[model samples]
Structure formats: structure tokens, C-alpha cells
Target chain A: MTFSVEVNGVEHTTEPRPGQCLRTYLRERGCFGVKKGCDSGDCGACTVHVDGVPVHSCLYPAVRAGGHAVTTVEGLATAGELHPVQQRFLDAQGFQCGFCTAGFVMTTAALDEAQLADLPQALKGNLCRCTGYRAISDAVRGVTTVETACPGRAVGASVAAPAGPQVVTGTARYTLDVDVPGVLHMKLLRSPHAHARVVAIDTADALALPGVQAVFTHEDAPRRRFSSGRHENPADDPADTRVLDDVVRHVGQRVAAVVADTEAAAEEGCRRVRVTYEVRPAVTDPEEALRPGAPLVQATGNVVGEVHGEVGDVEAGFAAAAAVYERTFHTPRVQHASLETHGAVGWLEADDSLVVRTSTRSRSSPAARCATCSTCPPSRCGWWRAASGAGSAASRRCSSRTWSRSPCCNCAGRCAWSSPAPSSSSVPPRGTRSPCA
Target chain B: MDLHTVEQWVDARTVDAWRPGDAWLAGGTALFSAPGVHLRRLRDLGGTGWEPLVEDPDGRLEIAATCTVARLAAHPVALFGQCCRAFLASFTIWNMATVGGNLCAALPAGPMIALTTALDGGCLLLAPDGAARTLPVTAFVVGDGRTALREGELLRSVTVGPLPARTAFRQASLSTLGRSAALLIGTRDADGAMTLTITAATPRPHRLRFAVPPTAGELREAVEDEVEHWFDDLHGHPAWRRHLTFRFAEQIREELS
Candidate 1:
């Protein structure tokens, strides 16, 4: 259906699909600041002023926004003048990774002094993945000026992040903001059963879908095993994973992938790519997993490896100590819940070499792993960064593939030049790193 | 993340002539968050033309199905404001989440359920056949995430009577951002009758009344005997909920008395 809305004071008319949401529609229309941290309204990354009221655009239907006035981070600046909130954030050094900055700015800009008292409660919805709330709150509360020690360097000074002004003005770009042309959308068909063996995969139905480009399964991928958790050194973790495996280890594990022209088409293709599974007994408890007769998570064994360390002789240390205490504590598994999910865009170079840009910590490991899985030489693989956090292993387990000719919005291009942090010398490296752009 | 199965959308202004696989779209905060492969078409209620909120001459409030939590909080009804605080939703969520959506979601943690039920609220339901009926808030929710809503029936509005001059509220949760583990609300009627309602910690709201303010022992006995089942989930254990409910109930009684 044709949907028309006024965005950033410009009237935009577009034919949005029935299932399309305002979040995806706005981003597609070059409003890169509206991020999709969580498609659900839990995260306010997609917050925008709809008729002057902040609403999570992810939950708002694109068609429902017809004839409404919308204001995004990009609209905060008028006639090349910065909005007060944007300027305040810049002065306060309000962000670190800057993933959630635009949402916070949008919300804070609409607030008056009356609402500032409940600042914490008002901001409870928008989560910043990197920095603490002190700087952001200070920025919104108009605590702009801070004492600085050094004139040139501002060493140990509470200055704004290099990316602050761009972030607040809604011009900064993250991985998802990249406008890649003719990008193929990829979706995975995850296993529902925790422990199961893929008996058969019938892809004929999925392949029949109109826009389906490729349906990949274990048969299509290399049999080489590598750890999904990539460390600086490849030998640090167990090499126990393949690109696709016949044996599903746990629920939500990808068994097959569908690449199609559109996200909806890819998802429909994923749903259609049905596989027959032989369900096996699953072990959920860690103690049960260590039992002698427990089901093996890996073919080698459930126990990957063990490390034992001692600073001093245990018996001697205990005898010398007045008291000895030992307690077994259980720590739950944690995902590196970065505001921006892990994603990668890859396409073959003109010379047939593959180049990949991804949201990951280790730069070279993805290329090495991809080369290992695709039977390509390491020299033929190139790597780039898409944006990552300090410590998050969640993206390590899953690889987000952005295909060639996709809409690539290289955020680095916009910020790399005007970045306020004095490290302009690193700009040349980014230029060489982002080959696909 | 994409809604793959939704092929059709009907901008419904009315609740008539509903078809299969059709669902009402209110604020859509919960509906969009959930896996809705089963939903083929959405009947948009945004154009229903219902006033967000209204206060009749009788001092009773009529909250429209599309009324957002933020709007309801802005209303002068202080009791509702207290309940709105219990929602624990962010300003973004509050601006988007609706009162009817929370109640109709039938989640045990829904604060609207506790508020409306405790205040003797009634839901105005409109069936597909054009029949309309009013059901108390307590009878509307059958179980966790399950409501007594009939097929193709829509919640038009919820009417709540004037709040008691003397009212007390107490809520307990595992964490600041966590769902309510137990909620106790006490009210004193104009006639000096007392009503105690317990929610969140239970599968549904539990209510008890007395001609006069009951003693701590009487309140405790009534809660232990009447509250046959305590809602069990990750929010809190049933035992912990029962204990908290007992303690909070006493605090409410004392505060209201």
C-alpha cells in the first residue's frame, strides 16, 4: 500500500509492504539514525517523535504512520544548527559506543524541565550498551561544562566521545545503517529440538519460492570444524563447530540458511525449508551433563578441556593459613547483549577474492574461519569491522552474512574524517579495511 | 525479526464482519513483540474514533481501549497514577502501551488488572455479533496469558468507579526492573466497609471484604484459606509470594485503617 508521511519536515510518499514496520521503512528511506537494537519495544533504539510524542517505531506499522508528522535524530538539526540536546550531549561526553545515542537524544530533546526530575525513570527504556548513565543524564540535565586538566590533550578530562556530535545529530552510522545495493537477505532455519539428528532436509519447497536465491545445508558447506567462539589465537578454543552440522547440539542452533531477495521472502523460505529430525534425550543441567552416561554434546566428548592452576602448594598453603574456605558457586551463561546485534556483509571482489565486513572483535578470525569453511585460501579472504563491544561472545556463536551489492551504509566514512578524538592517523587503516564499500 | 506470514492488513474502523486469522491491533507493543505467525491480517483499531479517556458526571472513569498508559497516568485519577507506576514500563513503552492491551494481555504481572479489579472496574465488551456486555475485571482474565474474551470480541472500554478517599497500595518485586512478585491494595469504602485485593503473586487477583477493618489474624487467615493457588514463575517462588503477600497485606491494612 502507498503510505505517505512527513519525516524531518519533508513529505515522503512510498509504497510500504503490508507487513513492513516504521523502523525498517524509515531506515530504508535513508534515515540511518533509527536503529533496530531490538525489534520489540523493549529497546528504544527506534524511538522517533510521531506528532511530537516519542514512539517506538519498530512496533508502529509503517502504514499506520500515514499522514503523520515524524521527527528522527536526523531532523533534530535545523538549517545546519545543532539542537540543544545534541550540543549538550557533545559537551557532556555522553556516549561511548554511541549505538543508543540517537534514541536517547530524541527522547531527551522532547522533554522539558518538569520531566528532568524523573530522568532515570524516563530513560529506563533506552539502554546504552557502552557508557554509564551519569554522562547521559548530565548531558540531558544541562550540565554542559566540566573542568579539564590539559589545554591541548584534555588528558584525563571528561570530554565528549569523538563520535558524540555526529551521534546526537543523527548523522553517525552503525553497521545496520550501511546502504548496500542489491543486498540479498539471509535467514536461518533453527532447530527446535535441543538434541536431534537431521534425518533428511527437503529444500525443494524453499527453492520453489519466487525470490529464493540459495538454500544452504550441511551438504553445501565444508566439513572442516572450527570454533564459533573466535579468540585472538584460533587455538585458544575448541575446534568443534562446522558452518552447518547434521547433528543439532541445542535449540536455536542453525541447521540451514535461506538467502532471498527480501527479508520476508527469506523468512518464508526459511519456514518452508523443512527438515526431518530424530529427537534424542537432551541434557539441560550442567551436573547431569558431567554424569558418566550423559549424552555427549560433541563427538569427542562433552568435556572440552580443563585447566588447573595453583600459585602455591595447596597442602602447605592450607597448613600456613588459619582458616580455609571453599564454596562452589554457579554462574549462569551470559550473552554479550550488545545493543547492535552482530552482522556481516560479504561479497566477492572483482578479482574473485571474498571481502567481508562484520560486527566482531577479532578482525582476521572471521576471514580465516570463512576460508576454512568454504575451502578458500587464506590469502583470498579480506576482513573488516562492522562495530563491536568490549566483551561479548554472543555474536561469536552466530555469523551475520551481508551479501554483495547490498545497501552498504559505511558509517566510518561519515565520522572517520570529522572524528574529534585526536587519533586521525588511524583513518588510513579504515580506508583500506572497508574494501566492499 | 520480520513478520513473514502477515500478507493482509485491514484498517478496521469497526469490529464487525470479522474473518478468520484476523486480530485487533491496539497499541501493538505486545502483539509485535510476540511471534505472530498465526496472525494473517491485522484489524487496526487506531481509527476507531474512541476518546482516549473520559470522566462522566458521576465521577466514574471510562478508559478507551486505545488509551495509552502515559495518557492514563496524566489523568487526574491518583489511584490510576499509583497503578501506572506499578507498570514498570519505560516512558517509551508507557507512551505506546495501552490500558486495554495490558488487561487483555492477561499476564499475571499486568498492573492494570490489579488496579481495575481492586477498584470495582468493569470491562465493556463488544462481540462480533454486535452484542455488548460488561464483565468485571477479575472475571475477564481466566489464566496466565489467557483471557475470557470470546472469539472476535473486542474490549471497547473499561469503567472504574470513583476511588476511595482512603486507599493503600503496596507492591513487592525481585528487582527494581523485575515484574511484580506480589501486589496488595487496600481500600475503605464510604460506608466504612473494607476491601483487600491481592494480585501479581497469584494466578489472578484475590479479593476479601469485611464489614469493618479486619484484624491482622483475620486478614491472614482469610488470605491463607481463600488464596488456593499462588502464581508460580521466575518472578518469585509460590512460597515467597505467599509470604510477601501476607506481609504486604498487613501493611496495607494498617495503612488504610
Candidate 2:
């Protein structure tokens, strides 16, 4: 539907796609500052001012935004001058990673003097993963005062992040914010049963979907195994999972991948990809899993690895002690819940060399991961790495540096490279003014 | 994902226009919160132009269906503010979710239902052919996600209490900043009668009334007799909810007494 709406004091009329939300509309129009932490309203990362009241744009329909004045994080800085809240955020160094910064800035900017008294309750809508709420609270309350005093030595003095201004003003772009043309969205079809043997996969219907480009099943996937861990030595952890596995060991394990022109089409394509599985009994409890008659989760006897190191002399130490105490402890599983979920964008270059943009502890780890998939089979075998710029000279033999990630023949002559952004060299441009036409 | 099935948006002005696949859009909080596959059209209620809050000569307050939680929270009425906080929702939700919508959603733990029911509130239902009907808040909400709202009927406004120098008590339980496990509200009417409305623990709001502040044992027995359908979800168990309900019932009775 074509409609005129005032965004950042400028009016524009455009046709919004079917069932589009205000967040998608603004972001598509180059308001990159409108972050999408959780597409649902729970995260409040897409909070923006609609008629000067804060609302979660992710859930607000684009159609409802018509004839109303909308303000985003990008609009907070006028005439190259940051608003007071943005300035306060910069002074407080209120953010790390900066994905959720725009939402916080927008929500904070909408707060009036009266609301400032209850900063904690007023700002409950927004969430930050890297930095706690104190720094954000300080930004609104005008604390931290931009301490520039290099008292005695640099070690004790608080140093401002070089990108602090950009972060505070929502001018910095994260990896997901990077625009890529002709990028196919992917959706995974996971195993519904915890323990099952994949009998066969029928991807004929999914591949026939109009927008679906490819449907990858275990039949066509590489049989190589690779460790998920980032330990320097590959032997430190067992290489259990394959890119696609025939045996479904756990629920929610990737069974197939569907790539399509759009997210909806990709999801639909995933739904259409049928699979036949032979259900097997599974034990979820630790003690039950250790029982002699329990079903094996792994072919190598459920136990992946064991530590047998002795500390001094166990019996002698306990014998000498007046009292003995022992307990087996367990901790609940927790998620990082990072504002920015881990993702990678990979595409083949002009000469079929991979260029991937992803984040990992080690730069070459992605290449190393890709290398293991192509070189090492399910059985115990040595693997190699393919460094970027190796191009056509990509080595088939193992290299000393084990972390390089170069795609091989199984990649269908495609590869990806990774990089970071928003440094001095890169800038999140103030997109074309209004595009009022 | 978006609500792919929605094909039309209607700026609805009255209850007579209601259709099979139509959903009333007030604040759009609950409607837009999830993808409703069955929904084919949104009937916009924003154009209704109803006054949010109004006080008559008798001092009875009328709250429109469109009055958002955040707006209601700012009202001087102590019960309104307390009920608003019971949602435990963030600022954005408070800024958008409506009182009428909350009562209509009919969730067992809906604080609006608890507040209105405890204060002797009545819902004005605008029927087709320009007729208006009134139902007590307790009768309006039947059970979980179910309401007495009939076909082509619109919830116009809710009128609550002259209150008459009444003192109110509210107690809500939750592990963290999440859904309420049990919420119980008590009010001392002008006649010196104690009215306790129990929610969150049960599938529907249970009201217990005593001519005089009931004895601790009487309040416990009344709660046990009235509240039967307790939720056994992550929020709480039947026995646990019953225990909290009895304990809170006595506390509210004592506080009001």
C-alpha cells in the first residue's frame, strides 16, 4: 500500500509489502539505526517514537504508522549535533557491541523529566547484553560525567571508546546491518525425534517451490566430521557433528537446509522437505544414560571423552583429613542471549573464491571449519585449512595453520570470507535524504 | 512472521459491521503480538473517539476500552495504578495494551479483570441495532481466553465504583519479573462488607463477600469453596496456588479488617 508518513520530520510515500511491520519499513528506507534484537516486542530493540510516544516498531504494523510522525535513533542527531540523551550516552560509554544501543537511545530520548525519576522502571523495555543497565541509567541520569582526567597514569583512567560517538548516535552498523544483494535466505528443517535413523529424504517438492533455489539433504552433503570447539588443537575435542547427519542424535538437530529468495519461501520450502526416520529409544537423564542397558547416543559408547588424572594421592589425602566431604554438583544450562545472534554471510567471488563475513574467536577458524568438512571423513583422519587469497592456488594438502576456512569442490565452487565493520575506515552513511519522490 | 492471512483493514465505527474473520484493533498490542492464521481482517477501533476516563456527578469512573495501561496507571485511583503494575510488562506494553482488550483476552491472571471485578465494575456492551447491555465484570469473563461477548457486540466502556471511601488491598506473587502466579485483591465496601477477588491461581476470577470482615478460617473456607480451577502451568501448581490463595486471602482479610 502506498501512503505518506513523516519520518524524522520528512514525509515520504511508498508501497509497503504485504504484512510488513514499521521496523522493516524504516530499516528498508535506510534508517539502519532501527535495530531488530528480537523481532517480537519482548526485546524492545526496535523501540521508536510514534507521535512522540515510545513503541516497539517490530510489532507495530506499517499501515498503522501512516499519517503519523515517526522518529528513530538516526533522527536523534540533528544538524550534525547529538541530542542531550545521545550526548549523555556517549559520555557514559553506555554501550558495548552497540546492537541494542539505538533502542535504548530512542526510549531514553522519549522520556520526560518526570519519568526520569524512575529510570529503572521507565527503561525496562530495553535490554543490553554486553553492558549492564547501570551505564545506560547513568546516561539518562547524566552520571559518569565524561571523566577525561588522566589521573596519574593511563591504566586507572577511564578511556572512551573511539566509536563511542557513532555508537551513541546509532551511526555504527553491525554485521547483520550489512546490505547484500541477491542474498538467498536459508531455513533449516530439524529432527523432531531425539533418537532416530534417517531412512531417506524426499526434497522433490521443496526444490519445485517457485522461490526455493536449493534443498540440501544428508544424501548430497559431505560426510566429513569437524569439531565444534575452538580449541587450538583439533584433537582436543571429538568431531561429532557433520554438516548434515544421517543419524539424528538429538532433537532440533539440522536435518536439511532450504535456501530461497525470501524468508517466507525458505520457511515454506523447509516445511515441504519430507524425511523418513526410524524412531529409536533414547535416555535423557545422566544416570539412566550411564546404565548398561541404556540406548547409545553416540556410536562410540555414549562417553565422548573422560578425564582420569589423579591429584596427588586421593586416598592418602582423604585419610589424613579429619572429615571427608563429597558432592556431585550440577549447573543449569544458560544461554548467552547476545543481542546480535551469530550469523555468517558467504558468497563466491568473481573467481569462485569464498568471501565470508562472520565472527569467531580465531580469524582462520571459519576456513579451518570449512576445511575439515571437505578433507576429513567421518573416520579419524587429518584435515587441512584454506586461507583467503589462496584463490585458485588453494591447497589440497594439510597446512601448518589449522584454522583457515576455504570451501572445496563440495561447496559447488562457492566460498565465503568474514570481516568486521564501523571502524574509522567504515561508516554507517546517513542514507539518501528522504527519497521523498 | 507476519499475519499473512490478513487481507483487509477496516476502520470500524460500530458493532453492526462485525464480520466472521474480523478482529477489533484497539492498541494492537495483543493482536499484533502474534501471527493469527485465522484472522483475515483487522477492524480498527481507534476511530471510535471514546473518552478514555470520565467521572460522573456520583464520582463513578468510566474507563473506555482504548484507555492504555500506561495512561490508566497515571490515574489518581490507587486501584488502577496497582492493577497496572500487576502486568509486569515493560514500558512498551504498558504504553499500548488496553484495559478492554485485557478483559476480553480473558487470561486468568489479567489484572484488569481482577481490578474491575473487585471494585464492582460493569462492562457496557454495545450490541447490534444500537442496543446497550451491562454485565458484571465477573459474568463478563467466563474462563481462560473466553468471554461472554456475543457476535457483533462491542465493548464500549467499563464503569467502576463510587467506591465510597473504600480501602483497597492487593497482593500478587511471581518468582521474578514474569507472569503472576497468584493475584488476590480485597476491598472493604462502605457497608463494612469485605470483598475478596481471587485470580491468577484460578481459571476465572472468584469473588468472596462477607457482611463483616470474615474470620481467618471463614476467609480460608470461602476461598477453598470458590476457587476450584487452579492452573498447573510453569506459573504455579494447583496445590501451591491454593496454598497462596488461602494465605493471601487471610492476609487481605486481616489488612482490610
Cα lDDT tens digits for candidate 1, B1-257: 34567777777764458778788888888877766888788888888889997889988889898999998888776777878888767767788789999999988889988988888889999998879999988889767888889989999999987777778888888988657898888899888889998899899877788889999999999888878889999889999999999999999888877
Residue A155's lDDT within candidate 1 is: 80
How much DockQ does model 2 earn?
A: 0.45
TM-score of each: 0.91, 0.84
* Local accuracy by lDDT, each model: 0.75, 0.71
lDDT by residue for model 1 (A1-437), tens: 45689999988898667667888888988998898887788778889999999988888778778989999999988889998888888777677667788889988887767678888767877888666688888888778755565777678776444555666776665555667666666667888988999999999999899988777788775678877655667788887766678988878777877777777787889889879999998887878999998998887878876888888689899889999998999898765466775455555555655555555555566666776666557797666565442234543433322111122111121111112221112122142111111
Please identify model 1 stretches exceeding 4 Å from their true place.
Answer: A144-160, A389-437, B14-16
User: What DockQ would you assign to candidate 1?
Assistant: 0.64
Highest DockQ scorer:
1
Alpha carbon deviation, residue B35, candidate 2 (Å): 4.0
Candidate 2: which docking quality band? acceptable
